[model samples]
Each structure stands twice: as structure tokens, then as C-alpha cells.
Target: MTDLPVRIRPEIAALPPYRQGKQAGDEAFKLSSNENPFDPLPGVLAAVQAAGSFNRYPDASAARLRDRLAERHGVSPDGVHVAAGSVSILYQLTQAAAGPGDEVVFAWRSFEAYPGLAVVAGATAVPVPLTADGRHDLVAMADAVTDRTRVVIVCTPNNPTGPTVTQAEFDAFVAAVPGDVLIVLDEAYAEFVTDPDAVRGDAVRAAGHDNVVILRTFSKAYGLAGLRVGYAIGHPSILDAARTTGIPLSVIAAAEAAALASLDAEDALRERIDAIVERRDRLAAGLRAAGWDVPDAQGNFVWLSTGAETLDVAAAFAEAGLIVRPFAGDGVRISVGEEESVDRVIAIAASVVESLPQTHAGRR
Candidate 1:
């Protein structure tokens, strides 16, 4: 397509383009991206305003933020690695651990970014399908690993479809994999998980796993998505390898300041998170009562198995002034948005579910 003679990797060219969640107009409830509906905590806003040194570059290592995260996770500062976002760290870890002739294992219909990241790193993507209720088939994922498998990623409170792996499930899966294969537990929605049995990464790391990396973010519960500050906790040697792949000076001062401030205002932040969790549970309950096969939603969103009518159901929500993320034929993902949007979402969902045949996949 270009006049200039340039060589491009065919695999890269074949990868699907990344699409962001649809933006909403002023009158619409933008629930497509699972963003925290709450505005930044007042203390965090103050910190961002106080960081006025735009003329200077940020600390490349992000030592302050790293230390803060280490303290929270009860790890040494050297074990913590900071990056712009956890997704950015995923790409780095994939690049660091895998290459041509190697493979990366994760669940299908999980994070939309996983396949592309593996492709870019020149590793083959081996996606195990999710179970009917949308939870990962961890046994299948563990079985997929071969001698050539370089990395295994487990996403808890899985994105798009919201079901988390239990601690027992995670332990069995980990035991099945070879110790040489690096395991990355992506817990971006950890703060929102209300499930008593869900696997928490910090607990796993505390048990002395040398090859596991726990990835987390300030983007969700802490309301710092715009600033893009995420951190990883693992063995320092593994983190040192990942650090080599990151872009220089990417985690800026504003993000670090906002994260630190959010940590300081933990009680207020937890209150807001409590509100979101309550609303999320209510929304999922309402959807299921209305005859939809709503999955276990431990995150701040619910998954509707809309199946073949995914796009149509998504359009109906948009028409009713509620934006949702749809994965074409698979299903639609609706975030637990503002309190005002809840009734509208439930109303539209009920109407849509009634139209489907009782035997349809989305129906209960």
C-alpha cells in the first residue's frame, strides 16, 4: 500500500488491529471500557497539581513508586518493576521470554491484547478455550505447554468475560507447568474481586515462587488509568530481564505522584471500590433474573453471552444511550457504570433477553 520500498514482517501485518472501547457522547453512559466511574480522589488530584516540574525527565527506574508498591505487596524494592501500564509490561515480558519457535499459553477470549503481544514477540499463541461459564480451562492450558512453551499467562477476573480462577485451580495449574516456563499472573482487576476463593497474586509470591510475576495497576480501583502506572512483583533477576525491554522514561512524574497520593488516601479509595462492587453484583443479579446466562462477575463489569446477536444487542444498548463493548459473535461486555446508568442497562437487557428464543445460548 505504500510507495516507499520497505520490508514489513508478515506476521505483524496479519495481526488484528487494536481497537479501543467506543467513546460516548455527553448524553450517553460510556460503559464500554471498564474504567472507574469515580473521579480522582481529592488527595490524588492535589498530588498531580503539585507535581509541576514538566521541564525535567522522570526517574527512569521509578524508584519511589517501585518502593511504594513493594511496601504494599511486602516485597523488596528490587522485586518490583514499574511500567506505564500492566499491558505494556506484558509485551516486555513476552519479548523477554519468548521468540521464534517458542510458544505463549493463555486463555482464548481473555484479554484482547494477548494474541497481538505474542505475535509481536515472534512467539506462537496457544489459547485454551474458556469453559461454558467463561472461566478459564486451566487444566487444558497447563496441558498445552510443550518443551517449546516459554511463558504462561493467567488472567484473574478475566477481562471481557468476568470469572476468576480459584486458588486451588491456580495451584494445580502451576504444579503442572515446568519450573523453567515463566508464569505471569495478570491481576489487573484484583481490587474488585469479591470472591473468597479467588487466587491473589501477593499470596502466591509470598510463598516463594521464583518464576512467577504478579502484575497489577493503579488504573482501576485507584482511578489512574489516564496516567497509566502499573507494577510487577517477582524475582529481581526476572524483573531485570523485563526492565531491559521497556521504553526509557515512559512512567512519568504525574502518574507516580497520583499513585503515591492514592496510596495515602487508601480508606477513601476502598469506600468507592465498595460502592462499585455492590453495584456490579446487583447488575449481574438483575441480568440473570431476567433470563440471561450472566457469568461469575468478580470484576467491575458483567459478561453477557449474547452469542450471534452480540452486535445487535450492543447496538440496542447504544441506542438507549449506554455504550458497551461487543466482541462480534461472541458476546458483549458491559461495565458497571454510574448509578444513573444501572437502571437503563437493566431495562435494555431485559427487553433484549425477552426477544431471544429460550434455547438460545445467551438465555438461561
Candidate 2:
């Protein structure tokens, strides 16, 4: 690493940039990103074409899309805030809520971006470890809060690990947190969730907790990952603070158009989501049957608690033409990809689990 002549903030200098999942060659199934396998809706491209004004800047507020989302979520348009992606909104919320000497609390081994976001905001990152089953231990998280704590992020259908914070669990957790702390419910994979017990962000918004903000993205279930459009729903005042910290005009016209089109084609989108949910359930079940201690996967991916064998198992999957997200010694997260990939994952997983030592954590 080269040092610049200019002085850099030590925390900023120390922070590693966010890493995207590896891209696969044409032959391999790219399941590392937990991406939606389906293509964009039929109306999506046409909408992008309709909004083809390359010379013009996008509406900074993204009014139409905000209005549509507000209608869908039953919130006022001012309650909605759009950005480049939900992760971008997370950054904005972090900057808006926390700063030097403040603490940002979230589950460890969750989103790879959480810690970096806090650091970028000049805040201390308080990472509470997840439960053995790969679920957020909200009780422990609440216990981590202190006077310096400013923001708390709860990723439902938690990324990488694939377990959701149940509705009751979320309710209790919210009650435990102080009113001054902002609770950002990150539901990037909310559309893929089928569990009746899972927390619903929209319901939370309707209940009107001023400190809570719900984040959703067009990237996942809507299959608009390339466009990079996502929005937040919460109290207008809270959103105003986030807007103060956001990069202007980051949400472009094409992304906004595509999101609006996706909303119009909800029926078609629902079918794709339902398919992904079904695939995810089957994948989780197959891995478990293969003697892996798979977690409750409510999202569009499954977690393999590969423990000490993490990298080796991930490498084996890669050799078998499956690219999965590996968290070093923790586990491997395999997204529910093409229908054909499911059986391949199961076969490779069965062999890998058998190869592990008898006391390996991944073994059932």
C-alpha cells in the first residue's frame, strides 16, 4: 500500500473497502452475491429506454418513484428516501446518526459493510456476535448499547448467514433499545422471505416508531441489481437528516424508471420471488440432509457452518463450478441460484461434509 503525502484519518486509512462477491466465468454458477437469479421484468428495459435522456441529470428527489413507493408502503412521499442502493442509504444513515466518540451496534458476521460504514462515519463499531444458529442475539445486542451508542442496524433475513429476525423478536428488541438510538432495519432480501414469523418492515413503519428506518432495494427480488436503486421508509424528520448526509443525484433516471416499472409489474415480480423462495427452501433442506448443520434460511441463500474447513469447502465448491461467499473460518454462504445448481451444491456439499473431521462444526 502506498502512503499519500496528505494526512488521512487513521480509521479511514485502516478501513478496507467493501468487497463484492467474486464474479464467475460463463461456465460456473455465481452464487456468491446472494443475487436474484431472475432477469428484470419485461417492462423494465422499456422503462429504461423511455427514460433515455443521457444529456439530462436525474431528478435529485426521485419524486415519482418515491410517490409510488410511498403508495405501496402506505407512507407519505416525504417519508421515503431513495439512494444509489440500500447500502448507500445505510452509509447515509450512519453518517447522519453517529460520529466521533459515538458507537454503532450491529450483529457481527452479518453484512460485511456494517463495520466499515461506522468507521467511515468516524464512530466506533460495536459488533455483537450472532447466536450459534446464525441468528442475531438481540438481547446481547441491546446489552451492548451505551451512552455513546447512536445507531443500531438490524438486518432481517440477515445477509450471508440467511436467518431472519422474527416479528416478536424484533418487537421485543425495539422495546429494549433507547428512544434516542436509530434502528435501521435492513431488509435487502425481504422480498425473498416466506417465513410467516419474519419481521415485516412495512408493518413496522405503519406502527410509527420515529427512531426506526426501513431499508429496501430493487437489487434483490426486483432483479434490478445492475441499476443500483434502493429506498428507505421512516419518519420524515429522520429521513431529512439522512438526506442531509446523502450524495446528491446519486439515484439516476434509468434506475428510477426501472424501479417504477417493477412496481407496475408486481404480479410478474411476485411469481419470480415465489420461485426463489421455493428454491431456497429446497437448497436448505438438501444441505441439511447431507449432514450439514444448515441454519433457518428465510432469505434467498443458505449458510454452511463449515467452521475450520471454510476455505477448503469453498475451494471445493469453486472447483465443482460453484462460486459461494466464504467468511474464512466461519462458513460458506451459497445463494439459491439456477435450478440445476441446487443438485450440484447438494452433491458437492455431501462430499465435503464427509471429508470433514468428526468434530467439525458443519457436521450435523
Candidate 3:
């Protein structure tokens, strides 16, 4: 038979798929993905159960949830836009703003979605390297933006590395960017940040900046990763642009109910966060005491910078029935979870680090 028309978009053809945490076997302790190990809050579960009429479509506008979010964040409903998840909102924003000849910029080793989204939107991705301390090199990122730059994503408390950009740094970076270019601040791990100087992107957006968009998700602290609900706070025009891109209504329903319920269960969520934070500190101290290069992880996870052979340590952990997210040559990221899980991860990490040759050095 004659070859079927084999034309596909060149950008898509050349793009690499985003890698997620591996789920090898049921026995594996799944710490590869930075997901909250706690169960959904009681209120959130009740809300989901009450939402039994699956026959009806969700409120496309997500009016109720939006209003709740507005109150919580001290913003108007017009500034809020809900989607299936933060990633979905990001994809829509990329498609809406980035196109041929435009460039998307973000820090290297940040959220993995930035590059793929840029490629999908037919834009050039400019990845600036992170600072020596593993925080976003905001100055370098701002300097990387040019006339062709359409979107710049800043993932603070970054995925692999847990360091966050300070408020002053973020302010300076935003001031340096062109007003027309969209600045996406992906704050997926915002809830875990205890630093008083940490940048709260939502507050930045609320201050009347037309170019800034703050993306947040219920998947983290709310224990609603499976619900796939997230929202963006930004200028009304930007929100309108993203909303124009259609999202599935069913996902929206589950997200809205769960998010609203999560809001009501703030105390329970706070307790969960406290526990995770304590565990994170304990694990970090434990790893450090064992002579491992563990950083001050402000998120619900820790990073072990074993330099070039991070994969070896990751494999060692895997062999011990622990699945960790390895950034190949970069480092291994281990998610903080329940007390027992956290202790087990630290124990395994200590053993792995000790077993590795002393030649494998750690970086900042």
C-alpha cells in the first residue's frame, strides 16, 4: 500500500516526552513523584461523595470555587481562572501566547513541563542554568529574555531542587522583564515554604501587574493530586485568554469540589503540612549527619546532590525497594511523606551514600 500522508508538526516530531516518576512494582515506595502521602482531608472526601450526580456537566466558569479562591487570596473572581490542573492551565497559556519565532524562558532543572509546552507551542526554549545554590538565577533568566521572548516560567521551590526565589529577587526579575511578555510563576509547592522572604506570586499578581500569572495546584498540600485541580491568578485579560482554550468540564467539577472542601479543611491541611515539615527537617539532618549532601529542602522533599553519578545512588535506593526521582547527572530528589516512610527513605539514603565511593562529590 502507498505510504499514508506522513506529515506531522516538525516541533512535535522533534520534542522529547516529559518524564514522570516510575511506578515499577506495588512493593516499591513511590517517592519518585513529589506527591503528598497523606490521605484527602475529611471535608474534601465528603464533598466528593456528595458530588454524586455525575450525569451533569461541571460549571464551566467554576464560579463558586473561583469566588472561594478569590477570598482566600484576597483577589477578585475576575482574576481567578480554574482548570483541570496547573499543568493544563500552563499548556493553554503556552498555546495562547507562544508561537513561531517566539521564545519561552525558564531556569534549567525547574518544572519539566516548561520545555515541552514551549515546543508544543512552536516556540524556542531558552533554559538558563540555576544559581550555585540551586535557586532560580532570576537575574540570568531576566537577562535571557529578548524581544522574541513570549513567556517566562519561574518555578520557585523548584521541582528537583527545593530552593525558592526570595521576594526581593522575584521583584527585581519582574521589574526587568518587558511588560508585554507573560511571566508565569509556577507555585506548586508554595504551601510548604516557611521562609518569610519567599516570593508569593499571587500577591505579585494582585498588585495590578498585567504580565504576571501565578499558577497553583491542589495536588500538593490538599492531597488531591488524583483530582487534577489547579488554578491561575492573574490579569483578567490573561485569564480570559486562557479560558478561551477549552478544558474538560468533568475534571473541573471534581477539582472545584475538592478544592473548596480542602479550603474548609485548612486546619487539617495545616496539621499535615506541619508533620511533613518536621519529617523533612529530620530527614535532612539525618542525611547530613550521615555525610550526604542534602540541602535545606523547604518543600515536601529533599535533594541529594551526588554530582555526576546521581543515578548510581538512585539505583542503590531502588535496589533497597525505594523509588526515587533521579535527574541523571544532576541529583536525586526524594519526596517527604509519612513518618515511617520518611524515616525509611532517610535510612536507605544514608546507606546508599555511605556505600558509594568517596570520589563522588556533592555540589551546591
Candidate 4:
């Protein structure tokens, strides 16, 4: 075959591939994707079961779900944008706000998708490393902004590292950011957070910040990962821009039904959240007690900083029929799931830690 044109965008070609946890079939305890371990909330299964109009197309506007979300968040329906998943919303946001010469800023190792989304949008990604304590270095991120900075993503109770950005820190960061730059807060795991200091997206919008967009997903706390529903709350104009670049409408419908059902089961969902929190704390303590350096996790997962031995620990867990997420050069992130799964993970982790050699060289 003749040589293909070397016309592909440099950013797209240079982007690192997105990696997910190993699929479920190979392992007994799969706690890699940060998914809610609970079964679908009451009425959720029935609602999805009732969604049988496979012949007809879904509502293009996602009007009902938009209305529900708007009412819940106390915003006009025009200010809401629904998509197949929050990641789709993120992609749309990048397309709407960043391009060619613009830059997108976020904490390094926060969300793997942020950098890839920035590259695809033809924008430069400026990643500010997290604090030594694994929290977002908001001050450093704010300082990284320049005239070309078009968007910034703050992932509260951040991925991998679970500490949240406090309201005070968020308020200060917002004040420091220029009005023209869009700040997208990805609160995918918001429902699981119980800290008084955690920043709520609804509170952010109610403060009347036009440049801010708050993203939420039904996948985590809502227990709707298979349905793929997520949304954004922002200025109407910004929502309009995101809508123009988003996915098909049917995915939107299933997501809407799942989300509405989830809201209806709020009490039950909260109980599940409480369970997850309890499990997370117990798991973290168990890991620490076993001599693993586990972070204070506030999300549904805990981080283990094993340095170069991260992959070895991951392999050991897999060998024991467990699955966990390993971050190159960073650490491993193990999700808190059902009681049995959590126990299996703790057991596997304890064995892995105990078996490791004392020195880095010995471990290697």
C-alpha cells in the first residue's frame, strides 16, 4: 500500500490511550472501575425494563430528565445539558471552550481523560501536580493559567487520590481565575462525599458564576454505570454549545430514566453511600495496619503508594482473583465494593504487603 498522508493532528497522535480496569470475567473480586457495588435502586430496574421502545428514537432534547435536574438544582432547564456519560460532557466542554492555541489546566493524575480530551480539542494541556498529601494544588493550578488558558477542570475528592477541595479553596480559586476561562468541576463521586467542607456544584452555580459548569454522573452513587447518563449545569449559552457536540439521544433517555429513578430512591442510595464510606474507611485502616501507605480516602476507593512495586502488587492481587487499578509512576487505586469483595481486597493487599521485600531493590 502507498504511504498514507501524514495529515493526522499531532496532538491526537501523541495522546496516550485510556486504560480501564480488567474486565469482570477473569476475576472474582473486581473493584477497579470505582463503580457502586449495590444493585440498581428500587424502581430503577423496572423503569429501565419498561424502556422497550427500541423502534422509536429517544427524545433529542432529553426534556424530562433536563426538567428533573433543573428542578433539583433550581436552575432553568435551558441551563442543563445531558449526555451519554459525564466523559461525553467533558469532551463537549473541551470542544466548546478550547482549540488550537488554547490551554486546559487540571491537576496531574486527577483524571486520565482530562489530558486526552484537551489534546483532542487541539489545546495544550497544563497539568499541575497534586500536593504531597495528594490533594489538588489549587494555588499552583491557578498560577499556571495564562492568556491562552481556555478551560480548567477541578475534580473534587479527586480520582486516584480521594481528598476533596474545600469550599474556601474553591472560592479563592474561582476568584483568581479570569471570567473568560471556563471552570468545569467534575463531581462524579459527589454523592458519596459526606465531608462538611466538600464543595457542592449546585452551590457554585447558585453563586451566579457564568463561567462555571458543574458535571455530575449517574454511574457512581446513582448505580447506573451500564446506562451511561451524565449532565452539566451551567450558563444556558454554554449548555447550548455542549449540546451541539454531544452524543445521540437514546443513550440520553436510558440515562434520564435511571437518574430519575435514582433520585426517587434517595434514602436507599444514601444508605448505600454510608455503607461505602464505612467500607472505605475500614479498608484504608486495614491497609495501613498491614504497613501499606494508604491515603485518607473520602471517595469509594483508597490509594496505595507502592512506587515501582505498584504493578507487582496489582499482579499479586490479580493472581489472587482480585482486580485493582494501577497508575504508572504513581500508585494503585483499589475500589471499595460489596462486603465480601472489600474483604477479599484487604486480604489480598495484606498478603502482598507482607510478602514485599524491605528495600526497593529487593522488591524489584
Better of 2 and 3 by TM-score: 2
Per-residue alpha-carbon lDDT of model 3 for 126-172, expressed as tens digits? 99998766789888898899999999999878887888888889888
Q: What are the RMSDs of all candidates, in order?
A: 1.1, 1.0, 2.3, 2.6
| Residue-by-residue lDDT tens digits, candidate 4, 286-328 | 8777777665587889888777788888888888777889886
lDDT digits (tens) for residues 1-364 of candidate 1: 3443777788876777889899999999999989999999869888988876899998899899889888888989999999999999998899999999999999989999999888999989999999999999999999899999999999999998999999999988888999899999999999999899999898889878788999999988888989999989999989999999989899999899998999998789889999999999999998988889999999999999988999999999999999999999899999988999988898999999998888998898
TM-score between model 3 and native: 0.94
Which residue pairs collide in model 4, if any? none
TM-score winner between 1 and 3, please give it: 1
TM-score of 1: 0.98
* Cα error, candidate 3, residue 326 (Å): 1.3
TM-score of each: 0.98, 0.98, 0.94, 0.94
Off by more than 4 A, model 2: none
Give residue 148's lDDT in candidate 2 (0 to 100).
98
Write the candidate numbers in order of decreasing lDDT: 1, 2, 4, 3
Task: For residue 262, give model 2's deviation from the true position in Å.
Answer: 0.6
lDDT of 4 at 360: 35
lDDT over C-alpha atoms for residue 72 of model 2: 87
The lDDT, on a scale of 0 to 1, for candidate 1 is: 0.92
Counting clashing residue pairs in each candidate, in order, gives 0, 0, 0, 0
